[model samples]
Target chain A: MDEIRIFAPATVANLSCGFDVLGCCLDTVGDEMLIKKNDLGEVRITKLTGQDLPLETDQNVAGVAAKSLLGELGSKQGFDIEIYKKIKAGSGIGSSAASSAGVVFAINKLVGEPFSPEQLIPFAMEGERLASGNAHADNVAPALLGGFSLVKSYDPLEVISLPSPAELRMVVLHPLIEIKTKDSRSIIKQNVSLKKAISQWGNLGAFVSALYTEDYALLGRSLQDEVVEPIRSILIPYFDDLKQVAMDKGALGFGISGSGPSVFALCKGNDIAQNVKTAINEFYKAKAIDFELHLSEINTEGIKILE
Target chain B: MDEIRIFAPATVANLSCGFDVLGCCLDTVGDEMLIKKNDLGEVRITKLTGQDLPLETDQNVAGVAAKSLLGELGSKQGFDIEIYKKIKAGSGIGSSAASSAGVVFAINKLVGEPFSPEQLIPFAMEGERLASGNAHADNVAPALLGGFSLVKSYDPLEVISLPSPAELRMVVLHPLIEIKTKDSRSIIKQNVSLKKAISQWGNLGAFVSALYTEDYALLGRSLQDEVVEPIRSILIPYFDDLKQVAMDKGALGFGISGSGPSVFALCKGNDIAQNVKTAINEFYKAKAIDFELHLSEINTEGIKILE
Candidate 1:
């Protein structure tokens, strides 16, 4: 096929105690990209929709990722790309990751799947570097591979897919405020006490075990970020109150999504997820903040083809 | 029965990346305790063997743990305790944990198990405090609960048992040099950079997942210790060379056990475990250091009754 369309899911990185290592995909909020071969042999962003993002090939994450993949294949074959973005940029929900991963995924398919999903990570990470200064794969890995992912090492780029409980559901609340990724990251302290580091790793280890055993209570208890959240949460409005409200309304756990302006809570069932969403909405209303809420199950199939 | 004998297995704490949070039990080396009920309402250490340890009840870890359990149970009954220490002190193999946990296990049995294994953690921790100033439970938790364990929190004391693969074996080598727990702990820097902490937590999350999923290769890769080992390994002789030799000899992973002097390597099967042990022994012999080596499977049973 000379043309293909693919959907890449939004991802939640950091995952409380996991910091830069853990992430999972969301089923509903994502970006769709359509790719068609061009005779000019130049990769270009022909059209865009839903959000105002850069259309320049070098400036856009999707274009950059697609160009990187084509360069790896050593093909002069160019492609015209169209991005239909649903995940909002600066929402801390991996909007850029969806664009980057979605394009590489579609292009890989257009070339008869010369590279595996794992091989596409570096190209996608290059796109992430364009969006943010750092080449982090936490968001892109889950967006490309699906379910939950652990970026075990970034130096050699090792990513591992973790088991996600079938009953797990996520409630995401996006406040209509922008928090730049660079500013969000700059607020964090460069050093932490050794004692606190130990505590964080303990929770991280327990969290991974809980995922494997499907122990909901253990998972909830392990959703603590003693190191990062304490510093970064100050930048987000009503962060503490929102989390407390969600917890009181039966969210298993709650925390900021990625950097800020967006927050998420994990619940075991659809009913509790709905309750959490309502609770978050009520909190937002009382504070007089415009917001959007989305309830979704863990996206097991990350990126998919659409005719 | 008015009298009982119990054996608490040795443990390897800090398991590389996990530092104050993770530990696993070793099968063969342990401390055995014998407790006999007496009419006098006072706990006493009656006899000792195998090692020169404190005989005063209040100063000893076993005596301290037994007293704590009795206090919790509010029992007026007294006991005469006999200690047979097989695990060497200051060897970085949870010697104090074996002693502390063994007495609690025997005393609980004598009183018809007034506390579940997990409930005995606080008492064992009390014993550990008598050994080390800090009431750290990494070693004690694994000794009390068996197999691999994660101490998720210490304030309220939450400990969770992680699954261990059936084929997992450990080769522990004690180089016969004493690295005092206080000295071993003091060498570590009080503060760690956020970047290093993130790396350590990443490995820890992957390591826990590896344990549950039984991914041996992943487990090996995740055994990296960027935070603690770099500092503590300086105290151990030939630490780097020994680890390289172990890895070259087909061992899955190698790192300092707890602090220093004692180092352990993880291997997949019995043959590889034997090879690792032999390789460590040859390395020690060439260095002209007195050492002891033990090959063991992961102790599924932490503390056991002796008939």
Candidate 2:
């Protein structure tokens, strides 16, 4: 009861239509973390490996997220944290979100489950704030609650967990390039035409319905981003060519994951996902860029307990 | 198969968050029309009553809609149409849509149903274009397909029918004053802040999810229109006062029905709907404005047959 080990998965945000609101968890790509209760009555990051991240309790994403939860309760109960990082920093696949969500999730269990998974979102968001100056729930939410999560509102912090279809799979490609969320976001215009805004919401609304009805084709048709993608996609290398090949290879939909450097192609089945992965791999291999490819099912369970 | 009488239902569009793409059908408030086959080899509005309207096939909404369907099929089949209009035009409750949707639905039946209710949407939309300069399908799609319908795309014209909750009710108040859709639309800014657009799509996506799960409270929370409501609500008299009273009376959510002059209060059940309606009636009466209030259930069956 004093110690716990878990898997903290990566996530894909801005799923084409629902910008800054929709995200999903990945099953196979994540980081492993260990948490142990300390009698010293102090929150500490005792071990950090595989990634050169801040070790200070006040500077680290996971450290800050853990302190936020403990500080809110005024409980001096402390813990020693260890993060075996696998997901790289600034790959745009919610790298910092996994660390933040994993630490809070682990600490909450050690304290006898004081809050529900939904309640853990804000605490995990503190990590996101430390990592990227903005406390966005799109990544940490799905990494906590799993499946598809929609941040309906931010002022009240309402996050709704959506149903995931069994056949859904994601083919993710990270080009080993870093795209800072802030720098990428700067290129986007502050104002958008009302006409395009209407189209965005129409596609997003249809996308939500497609989830409930399990209509894969409808989901694909609804996966359109006329507003943000046109502006932000320019930052990524060969973004347009990658999207075209993904769609031509039978991906249900394709878009820049989070702010970019990492892109995901949503597919109906593993067969199509593999085909898309291979096609993308072959297409990007000629670019002479160092990159990695990941194929994962929709992670229904967000953070998992390890043996 | 020579003669047919039918009831065409009214519809409420722009359900707050979904400005141009969402609408639902009303059960009790609509118009009745009668059509009889003729050997004149031309579409005609043989009789006109209840309200002043053009009888010419080119000028009339119903006649234009009917001709559009016939012309598309290259059919010379003629029909004598009698219009018994009950819905007042320019009230923003889809009055023109009822007549246009009604006539096309009846004619399709008379001609042995050459197209389904969904396929009849474009033909019904001709009536909308005749009534207004723009050919929007929010109202007509619901009146033809029944229940709640989302206009997912306008280019390829993909219309999706959404599930309606059993306890849902709508309280519609038409304040007699007319606000032209064109004029009302002009008040809305051509561009909106990206933050506001994100909020809008987030709420709309949640609203679609609420409809599927029948979560009434969530539906109420999701009925927010930050962009259009602030600009367009100014045209309606005592707009803020009426919305306040409806919410105070336990209405689920309230907003402008279409363009203006007409507003709708969404409530959970019949009792709440009636309470909201009565409160709105009393509030409007004090403003020295003539208004009509209607309480209606979500109409699952759009156009109905009559003896």
Candidate 2 — which residues are off by over 4 angstroms?
A: none
CA lDDT, every model vs. true structure: 0.89, 0.93
DockQ of prediction 2? 0.92
- Which tens-of-lDDT digit does each residue in B1-307 have in candidate 1? 9998888788999989889999999998888888899999988999988888898999988889889999988999999999888888899999988888888878888889888999888898888898878788989889988999999988768999998899999999998899988888888899999999998988999899899889998889889988989889998889999999899888889998986679999999999988888888887898878888999999988998889
For candidate 2, the docking band is high
Candidate 1 residue-wise lDDT, A123-216, digit = tens: 9988888988877898999999999898888877788898899989999999988998888888888999998999999998888889988999
Positional deviation of B208 in candidate 2, in angstroms?
Answer: 0.5
Per DockQ, the best of the predicted structures is 2
For candidate 1, give the lDDT: 0.89
Model 1 misplacement above 4 A: none
DockQ of every model listed? 0.91, 0.92
Measured over all alpha carbons after superposition, the RMSD of each candidate to the real structure, in angstroms, is 1.1, 1.2
